[model samples]
Target: MSASHTHGDCCDHQDRHQFSLRKALIPIAVSALLFVIGLLFNKALNNTPYSVGEYAVLIPAYLISGWSVLITAGRNILRGRIFDENFLMAIATLGAIAIHELPEAVAVMLFFQIGELFQDYSVGRSRRSIKALLEVRPDTANLKLGDQVREVDPKSINIGDLILIRPGEKVPLDGEILSGQSQVDTSALTGESVPRTVVTGETVLSGMINQSGVLTVRVTKPFAESSISRILELVENASSKKANTEKFITRFARYYTPVVVVLSLAVAILPPLLIAGATQAEWTYRALVLLVISCPCGLVISIPLGYFGGVGGAAKRGILVKGSVFLDALAQVKTVVFDKTGTLTQGNFRVTDVISENGFTQSQLLALAAQVESQSNHPVAQSIRQAHGKSVHKSGVQEYEEIAGHGIIARIEERTVLAGNDRLLHRESIPHDVCIVEGTVTHLAVDGEYTGRIVIEDELKEDAIAAIQALHLQGIQTVMLTGDNQAVADRIAHTLGLDQYRAELLPEGKVAALEEILDRASHTQGKVAFVGDGINDAPVIARADVGMAMGGLGSDAAIETADVVIMTDAPSKVAEAIAIAQRTLQIVWQNIILAMTVKAIFIGLGAVGVATLWEAVFADVGVALLAIFNAGRILR
Candidate 1:
């Protein structure tokens, strides 16, 4: 762990909120103290209606609590940007003061400041959750300079520079361990509590804490491009890309605020001027109440805060929904497509069966196949090498060649060894009996004679079946697409009870399949999500309505293209993210309905002079507080 990253309790998510709360308390306490003093002197004693001495104390109370808001309103009005909550509060409270309702005027600003403090607290909590990953990297690194070490800023360290990480220090940058053996805690970045053991030649990422043993690391990435930095950048900028609902609310407020102001103007002037019994004092008081009721504080604060809290909640659960737009889309998802390998099944391949031909022992055929396949990084090749249980001599191979999809051909010793799929043997004019297998297989030939075949099986993830069942229960249709052979894809798809499966799909084919699913969802009034974790899946991830990446063990490309990233290598997180999105939307709608319904009734009452200025404070600031409380549930 870096010096900054301690093995502290995971429940340390409250520090930021506490800090914001401290700053908010000063204003809240001051406003409430002065407002209460004004109330006692003006209302409780002598049944005093209005007095010059009262105005002296009450006006100062309003100014103390709301001077910033008044200044902002004045500045915005001068800048021709006047329709906002600040303007609404400023106008309504000042109008009340003009009518000699000193207590109500002071109360309005005081309560509004309290509401703002709550907003700051709630927003601060959400921000901490979203930006928690920013704490992964240490502020400085122990740089190695000419056999001596000195602490330096991580930003100042260049790529390929050498650094030392002692026990309890966070790895400052993405680097390879030059010399060390230690278990590094990666929970901060990957969200997995288990510590990963690392040794020489192993790559470690920035933000991981070294549990034990000192490591000399060769940095591979600069601080700016490190994992933690990229994730922070993605999260910080996510809010800028507003959801459709947010855009609609923005447009609604732009027209709605001005319209309400004009209506309040008509209510104040028209009825009193035209009607014989109507008095200017009563009508203008009603107009002031109307202004407070019309402020869109509830809708404006609750909607975006709802999404912000949702994102924060998701981060707490090890899921990263890049933006509110993706969260909204995930809630409406009806079709979920999955890339077979690394998504549904463990990408790790294991040799399950071996066959021999040409009077060769299974062991000999395995050894020859392993030697030829050693040069390839394909999962099948790795599995074959692992199964052989013996290392091949590098000098034993004369010539080696890797034919893209066909596999490998090499001159092992004096004999030519061919190890690959059925296509490789056929291309080499070698005849071999077709082998029946349920998983991926590599057919081998030696010196123009058919040697044998090895079958490699990819086990399904422990949670794959459960994840599929969960989606099914949610009424989401599931599909699987892969480049694997038809039989293997068919069996896995059937075993998992998926709705559909497409086999032998290339990278482009996955995109084509995703487009078709999206077209279908468009007609069905739903969204389509594609789950994947590879470079090949990146394009499909970017094309889908919502892309969920298996962030842990997933390729960088897939994570970058995905709209949502499941921090663990679990398929079940997809369902978890959807549940969060749905809950978040539910809270947002609840707030919208509650705010609108209450405001409408109050606005009607205020226009007819049936509601008092005190009631107007409840309509605006009180409703905002209630809606905010409703929105906070999304984070929990």
Candidate 2:
């Protein structure tokens, strides 16, 4: 089924109106004010012709818009380390004044101020997207004390408290349901779009909303231990983990600024002395112009802006990228491993068949099997109970034992009841078919009599095929790893067009599979991503180059380990994320190229005595404006 929800419309009416006003009126206000002042000052200085008050109006305009920036630039320079944006802008505007080009200097500063304002506006929009993703945290939770209901802070909720969840309400804590039935939207936590029907004895995650029925859940984790809180914390601080790209930019800017400064000085001094008849003053001025032109502001801003934009964009679409590193890593990911059940399929069990081997009827076999497995809290056992229509009375059972990693054995109505896998039946010397190639089958026996088998299948998600197809289109190889039987795993892998499959993998076995893929990636781009929607798959998710969690399902462990999260259960979003990252990186390079190109062209002209101080101001300021415009594409 298809679902839709609007995102990121949180701005208040006044805030939105202010944003629109700023966009429409701020520059115009500055420009019109400058023009009117120039006229008034020109009239006032009519007697003194040398006043040049027409040009002097720019000074007031510059002060209005560029004062804060100029002060910041001065402070940065005084600190003995001055390779920041403010330093570059200060040098460029000041150099224009050196040549006595008053109007040009004012225009240059004005344009720079406008560019900075645009940058601030765009970054603010990005922050809004981040905030929207974070707004999923609910304000309150329903706590049940005996028969009474109380509303309290979600943060104050503790483990084992019965939290009542209503239809259309987000499940406040990760817990097991004690009563009622409902379909939960786990898309936020699992990246699976289909809503899962959860009844009594089923686990529900925090942030998952109940679509139908009322559920009284026994919280298994505290509010602090809840998945939603951890996810919010991880995403909020993702910027702290510097990706290789960010580090490279940092190191590049650190050295590039110093080298450029030295080169500018060399250009100013060497040419006049070495070349005959070359003027020292002219050469010095040209070198300063070159320094003004090559500020590297575009390079610094664009690169980080690109990643930030990509992260914000993905977040808007319900994907939380922990850092720029994950965005970069995701682009380089050639191999992607997915956890089978919650990641690939819906992770809900449905009864496929009820086979009666001997002379027993189907209803008789189901009653005996459900009676034996009713005490266990396993998916397969739940499926058996579900088929039986209601919870069986425990009064009929005597000795009930749940074997780890196997099935349950119980004594019901003076008879030995075994409701488990074929191994449980074989151990009891019960005769039954050992295997099937279709769905997962659980064997049933009563007093050493082979009753029958019930086949169960975890259905694939509706968009599972589309999501896999989209991944393949992005040139990523998809693989499935699961602890399920080979036949079940293979069926899903085949249907989803998975490039590879590893079946019957234990939880540890999934980790081993990830290791093998990581080893192979070392020969290629040295990157791999693991996507899982389960708590058990957290280890493998962390082990991969980029850990991706389906946050819609609200798996706390998955959210903690994964570097990237899909807030909506849309597999196709994987492709969208990769596309956004690639696009962002491309835009960063484009801005860098555009800035350097204009600087190089104008600097060359300045050295040849063709580009004057006015031209120098234009090159410095105009290029900065262009780069800022290019960077805005990220918001789009």
TM-score of each: 0.89, 0.78
Candidate 2 lDDT, 1-636, residue by residue in tens:
000000011112223443554654475477657845654665574345655564466566666655655776666567665665556556655665555444555665666555555655666677676565355567889999988999999878777788888888988778998999989986555445678888888788776778999999998988777777666676668767766766766776677777767877787789988999988777767766666666665556556666778777776666778888777788788887888766677767888889887788999888878888777756677778888896688789889997643477888888887777655676667776657558777887777888788888888888889988988887888888877777887788888889999886667788888899999889886578888884667778878888888643456676667788787655667777777777777776787678768877887887677886667766766776676677667767
Q: What overall lDDT goes with each candidate model?
A: 0.81, 0.71
**Backbone collision tally, model 1:** 6
Error of 2 at 535 (Å): 2.7
Highest lDDT scorer: 1
Query: Which residue segments of model 2 deviate by more than 4 Å?
Result: 1-28, 35-58, 78-80, 134-154, 157-228, 269-281, 355-378, 392-433, 444-452, 634-636
